[model samples]
Target chain A: MTERGLLIVLSGPSGVGKGTVRKAIFESEGTDFEYSISMTTRNMREGEVEGVDYFFRTREEFEELIAAGQMLEYAEYAGNYYGTPLTYVNDTLDQGKDVFLEIEVQGAMKVKEKVADGVFIFLTPPDLTELKSRIVGRGTDELSVIEERMEIAKAEIDMMSHYDYAVVNDKVELAVDRIKEIINSEHLRVARVIHRYIKMIKEL
Target chain B: MTERGLLIVLSGPSGVGKGTVRKAIFESEGTDFEYSISMTTRNMREGEVEGVDYFFRTREEFEELIAAGQMLEYAEYAGNYYGTPLTYVNDTLDQGKDVFLEIEVQGAMKVKEKVADGVFIFLTPPDLTELKSRIVGRGTDELSVIEERMEIAKAEIDMMSHYDYAVVNDKVELAVDRIKEIINSEHLRVARVIHRYIKMIKEL
Candidate 1:
């Protein structure tokens, strides 16, 4: 039997460039991971393909899936539901295809509770100084605003304890490389691959 | 303070090319790991450097170190004592330079007991059939000898459970790449790197 593929969850605090890093990873050559498209009740935008941009679903269909416990994790915004389909993720993994999820920290924590075996990676900024500068660099020089942003960032960074690996988003390319290394090494982990050897020994 | 470097122990069954893989790793550019130079009581041959080749020591010195618990692991072969020096390994790691030890399965296990945090990697052939072919290819086709060799190989493969990673030495370059990935990913592991972030948080 083929080994199940990894469920890779990439998350970080707001403004840490999780989306940029995820885009770089997917665009890089030799990345065979299947991006887990969200099933959304929102209408498809211009130039958006059916399954490419998002798995566009009617509100009734999306709520039915949610009611049936088919959504891995879901959130409603502006009266629309967005979620990862549990069946698609499991089916793809069963077929030995890795599924990559790029979500916010709170959403990632919810997924962690459900998919305990998923590889949770926290993409952190180089340092709080850098993160602070990024926040200040966003044209907001207000001291209280900066302090509040830093406070939120710290809380999210504190959540890193729940992650298995932390990749510093110092450089997009470097973060992508480190994430790739994590995936490769995770595949070679003894716990994940030992069953094959055990089976081989039994056959011998 | 610099984070202590990892103790990477690479071992496998006999004839699994541990030496070859280790050599390839050191020869590869960007490999900054320091190979742990063993201390031996054997006389230095011509053109052998004192510290680079081996830490040449008299039998008395070796015995004193062993008795003093300065020897990490040791064994006598052909009346010559050979062992890893505990002091050197600790000093190098304390200086934030990784120490790579390429040894046999028995020596690896000993190191595991002494240094529980060491990254133990077991290199194995692609499969038992390939391993058997390698034995037969050695021109030792005697049924009894072949069976004995297979049994030994099986026993060594079973030791893989104690290792953090199992790399199949299917090709020298591929094995080298996988080992590099393991080291890179290990450095990113949350357990090894979270302290820095904790410190960063405190400073913030």
Candidate 2:
């Protein structure tokens, strides 16, 4: 039987560049993980493919999945539901293909509750000042909103204690390299790969 | 206070190329670990630097150190003493510099008993058949000796359960890369690094 693959979850506080870092990882030439497409109840935007962008579903369908416990983790934001489909993630992992999930901190926590063995990586900023600057650099939010975001970011950073690894997103490429290394080493861990060696010795 | 650096131990059964792989790692441009120079009572060979090659010591000095519990691990071989000095390893780590020890399987076990947190990596050949060929390829051992070595190797391979990682030495460069990745990932482990983030959050 093929060994199951790792479930890697990339998450962080708002404006920590989780999306940007995830994009860089997927765009890199060496990434072998299967990006898990999230299911959302939001309308499809312009130039967005049906499955490529997201598995867009109607609000009723999304709630039905949630009610039936088919979603690995889901959250309601601005009256819309966003979640990871449990079936796809489990199926991909069982086929020995790593699954990559990029989500919000709250959603990631929910995933942690169900999949205790998943590699939960908290992408942090260099410092709180830098994180505040990144939030303000967006130039869209008002001062009050930015301040609220900073407060939320502080709380989320506190939640980093629950993560398996805390990678500082000083640069996208560097963060991606660290995450890749973590995955490679996790595969080599004795708990994960020792069974094969034990079998080899038995055969010998 | 600086975080204590990890004590990385690379070991394997006979004919597994542990020395070659360790040498490649140390010679690599990015190696930052301090190679723990072992102290031996054997005579210094020609062209060998006193401290660089091995810390040459008289048998009396070696015995005194061993009696004082200064030797991290030691063994008597060919009527000579060879062992790692605990003072150097502890001082280097206290300075926040990593110490890399490449030794035999038995020696690694002894080190493990003393340094419980050390990263013990077991380097293995691709297969038993390949391992046998490598041992016989030496051309100096008799058939009976080769058979005896093979039996010893099997027992050592069984000790892999005590290690943190088991890397297959299929190619030296690939094995080195894997070891590097292991070290990188080990540095990012939440248990080892979360305190820094906790301090950061407190300051924020």
Candidate 3:
């Protein structure tokens, strides 16, 4: 039996740029991990691919999965359904390939409860002040919207206690390095080693 | 407002080179951290300092600290008293300096109970076979002594689940980087960040 791969949960406030950093990690260290494509009812936004960026699904199908307990964690937001597909994540991890789930703090908490053994890492800007600047710099939102996000950021920070670790997105490369380090460190863990040992003996 | 430093506990089986790695970290990173020198009744082993290396004390004094709850954790191994002093660690952390206690697994566990807020990182060799080779390669020892050490190592691996993280001592640079990442990743934590804010505001 192969030692199972780690299930990584990435969460933070909306404007913390977890998406950009994760994208950078995928583009560069793509071989290190596979991203978990969430199932959602939202329409294809801009350059998103159907099965790549997200597993675009109809409301009826999503509800079916939800009702069947096939959704690890789901929440309806902004008039659309979004959730982690339990089957794909469980299958990928069972195959011994590390997987990533980019999610919100609330959803991350929910997923963590369902998958109690999963690792949760919260990504954040260098500080709250920087987070405010980044949200404003996005330029798509009004000042009031940014202020609203700042409140949400506060709630996000408060919810961070649920996370196992946190990485600051000071620089993409550095953050990615830390993220990779975390994954590597987890592999060296004692439990995993013993699990590998038991299988090694069985094969011997 | 300055963020409070994390209370970190470093532990591993003997001959894992935890002390050597810790010394290298101090040399490279300088003294921004509080190296909690444990108190002991063990005889002065060559160039060891009284307070710097350890707090050399009488057996009676060691018992006194234990009775007073001044010691975080301790053990009597090889007929000598060895333990971590609680006051210095708490004081240094209160002053916003990161504290590192290089301890055995038992002592590390005790610190964990007191400071569950602390980060615990266990250091280990890549594999049990490698650990055997490393122990024998340390010096010319009898095969039985090597076997005894291996048994102890196996026990440590058994208790590895008690640790929060593990760093593989495959290479010096890699181990150092992982340990530093553990420290840095901890700073991004919301509990520590919010505590810093509260403490800073209280000062004003």
Candidate 4:
């Protein structure tokens, strides 16, 4: 039997360019990873693709998924529901495709409780100054909101210890390369091949 | 301060071309790994460098090292003492140069006890048939001895579970590339970078 693909959970502090790195990796050649689409009650923004950006759902529909334990992890953010659908990820992994989940730290923690073997990677900016500049550079948040985000970023960076790997988002391409190397190297982990070898040994 | 270099322990069953791969990696451009020179009481063979191949020593000198805990791991083979000198490995790592220790599975296990965080990699052939052919190709052993070696290879392959990674030495360059990726990716592990980030976070 083929080994199951790695469940890669990519998370980082806000404004750390996690989304940019994820996009580059999926777009790059030789990466066969499936993006785990999240279910969200938020309205689709301009240029957002249905079922690609997110699986848009009504509040009651999301509530039903949560009640049935179908959502791997979910949260109510800004009066809207957002969650990862369990079936999509499980199906993709069952087909031997690596599934990438780009979630916030809190949702990642919840996902960890459900999938203990997931590869948890924390992406970070080179420094807090860079992170702050990126937050300010967004041009969408107010001064007070940016300050709050900086505080949250500090707390999130402290949680890097909980992750299996950390990739600094100094450059988007470099970060993507590091993540790709990490994914390739992890596939060579002896633990992943031990059971297969054991069966082969017994037959021998 | 520069991060301490990764202590890379490479082990595999005999006839798996572990030595060939190690030499190729050191010869490759941009690889700056230091080989951990072993101390041995055996007389130097023709063309072997005194400090490079093995630190040729008298039995008394070798014993002194073992007594003073200077030897990381050691074994007696064919009435001669052979061992890894602890100072060489620790000093190399302290200078931020990766140290490569190529030894048998038993010695690798011993070194793991002393250095709990070392990256242990097990190299193997593509399959048992290939392993058997390689063993026979050596041309020095009798039929019985060859059978004995095949049995040992099976036992050693079972120990792959204890290693952090396994690279099939199907092709020398491919094995080296996988190992390089493992080392590069390991440096990005969160556990390795957490303390540095923690200090930076404190200042921020």
Candidate 5:
């Protein structure tokens, strides 16, 4: 029987190379996941275009979806709007396609609440100090800002229990390979609940 | 840091080829696992020496271990004493070797009760008719015995929810290979409860 695509929810610390790992997963062997395009009100950067980096939308459209309960989850950060569209994810999954969502810790939790059987993947930085380095390397934020990000990371890591699998993103390529492996492994799992409805071939 | 092994308990219906996969796991890619040698009071079969198939022991000796709480879990099946030795399993696990325990459902449950962190794998036949065919192929007894066995098999398959993982034994080699993959995949699972104590390294 052809296996259904896994609904994988992946999240990581601020700079654990999740994007790199995500790219590698698409390039890996036997991986059947498709990225779910998220609708956002944030304007595109210099070279970014609609339907590329994001499904860029206006504030009215985003709010209309939110008002209509079309948004799976959404939040405003630094005066920017971002949200996942319920229709896009549902359509992909119903067609037996695995869907990937690049979301924050809060968004991850929200997605899980919306999808009961969602598989949560928590990506970790190789080492805590390395994570701090990556955070600070983003062009010398105040030490206080770096420390605040570290604190947020600690809180995010603590939510690891809410996740089904955790990947250490020391090397982006390897982490992506592991993520792809996780999707493959999940397909082999038996139904958590099944009835004994036997179709008797011999009796027929 | 080197990862620790997962304690997996494998159980299933009699004709589901658990033994076949068990053997394949050892013969194929189980170099990391400490295949648990169970202790039994039953007489050894021809060429089945002590500590290989089982740790042949006297009934009194078995009772002594049970009394002293050395046995992880024990059962009296068809007038034979079968049990897992706790000390041997713990010692081997401390050395970072994965452990595979081929046990019955009841004993698997008991072991889970003892070790809350244990992972359970339940194997199932491809179909009910296939199970009956395999049981009849054994040429053990009459129609009544075969019927009784089928009834038990049905009950066992229905109990798959109690297990953490399940794989259909459609092909012995395939099932065995999948089991190996599950073990390997589990080893890469960094968020298991026992593994939480690992201090996430902080490095650039």
Candidate 6:
């Protein structure tokens, strides 16, 4: 019997190297995972593919999906619609491929309410000092903006209690290795194996 | 700060290759784990090293340890006492080393009650048919004994629900790989990180 794929929710505060760790995982084992393409009302960039990068939709269409209860989690940020579409995730899982959802903490909590069985992983910085330096090093935000992000990060780190696992992003490669181990071990959970045993016992 | 070592309880029914899988893992990663040495009142066989194979002890000595609350689990069969020594396990863990306890289902459950935080893993044969064949293949027991073992296997398989993880021993390498992943990922659990965060936040 084919086992259903795992749904992994990876979330972290800003500047925590979630992107770098995820990228390393994909580069290391590309075919084993499928990235969940989100739906958005924002304009697509030049290199972004239609279905691969995101499913671009109008505000009205996105709202209809929300009304129809098709979006797993959605949020309006700066007047732009961004949400996860449930069908694509379900389809990929039904095909026996693991789905990776990289979302923010708030959206992660929302997804947890719907998919209680999904593995929720919180990626964190090594320490507050390192987190501050990373934010300062990015050079994309002003000092005030960086301070605001640090505040948000503190709040998000408090939510680590809600997650099943926490990986400190000390090194991107090491963090990716830890996440891969987590995925491997979760597949061996007893709840996932009992069904197969039931069938075997019946046959016996 | 030094993280506490993990205590893993690995149990399975007869003919499930638990020993083979464990031996493979130890051979693969010799320095990463410590095997819990058991204490037994039975006579030591030739070539059996004391403290390594078993801490050969008299019935009086074993009973004294049991009365002292030093034995994690103990049972008497054929007028011989057999049990796991708690001090060895705790001392090894105190030094920040993973401890592997290979015991029966009942013993594993006993350890679980004593150490509520240990990881429990149930290993099983690929199928009932395979399990039956393996028992018969051993040629150490009669037909009636084999039948009784099959009945016991059914009961133990039902107890998988009480375990945290289950691995099918279809291939020794694969089962060892799964167990190794479980150990690695368990270190990344959220609860383990929350304490560290609390200290860091306080210093900040």
Give candidate 6 misplaced runs (Cα > 4 Å).
Answer: A41-50, A56-61, A76-81, B41-48, B56-61, B76-81
> Which regions in candidate 2 have their CA more than 4 angstroms from the true location?
A41-50, A77-80, A142-144, B40-50, B56-60, B75-82
Q: True contacts preserved, each candidate? A: 0.70, 0.81, 0.30, 0.81, 0.31, 0.78
Tell me each candidate's RMSD, in Å, in order.
3.9, 2.7, 4.6, 2.2, 3.6, 2.6
Task: State the DockQ of every prediction.
Answer: 0.72, 0.73, 0.26, 0.80, 0.35, 0.75
Q: A1-204 in candidate 2: lDDT tens per residue? A: 899999999999888988789889999888898999889888887787888868999999998998998999998754678899999999999999999999878789999999898899999998878987888897887889878777888888889889989888999999999999988888887878888888878876
For B133-185, candidate 4 gives per-residue lDDT tens digits of 88888877789988887788888888888899989899999999999989889
What is the per-residue lDDT of model 2 for residues B17-116, given as tens digits with 9 covering 90 to 100? 9868988999887778999987888898777888776799999999999899998998765467778999999999999999999877877889999999
Candidates, ranked, DockQ: 4, 6, 2, 1, 5, 3
lDDT of each: 0.86, 0.88, 0.77, 0.87, 0.76, 0.83
Best by lDDT: 2
CAPRI-wise, candidate 6 is: medium
Candidate 3 docking class: acceptable
Docking class of 2: medium
Q: Give the runs in model 5 whose Cα sits over 4 Å from its true position.
A: A1-5, A43-49, A140-148, A188-193, A196-204, B1-5, B42-49, B58-61, B187-204
Judge candidate 4 at residue A127 and give its lDDT.
Answer: 81
Candidate 4 DockQ category?
A: high
iRMS of each prediction in angstroms? 1.0, 1.3, 4.6, 1.0, 4.3, 1.3
> Model 3, chain A: how large is the TM-score?
0.86
Candidate 6 clashing pairs? none
Task: Please give, for residues A1-204, the per-residue lDDT of candidate 3 as tens digits.
Answer: 565889988888777878777787788743477798788898988888887778899999999999999988987754788889888888889998899998777789889888887778888777656776877787777778777776777777767767777787899888887777677666665556655544323332
Question: Chain A alone, TM-score for each of the models?
Answer: 0.81, 0.89, 0.86, 0.91, 0.85, 0.85
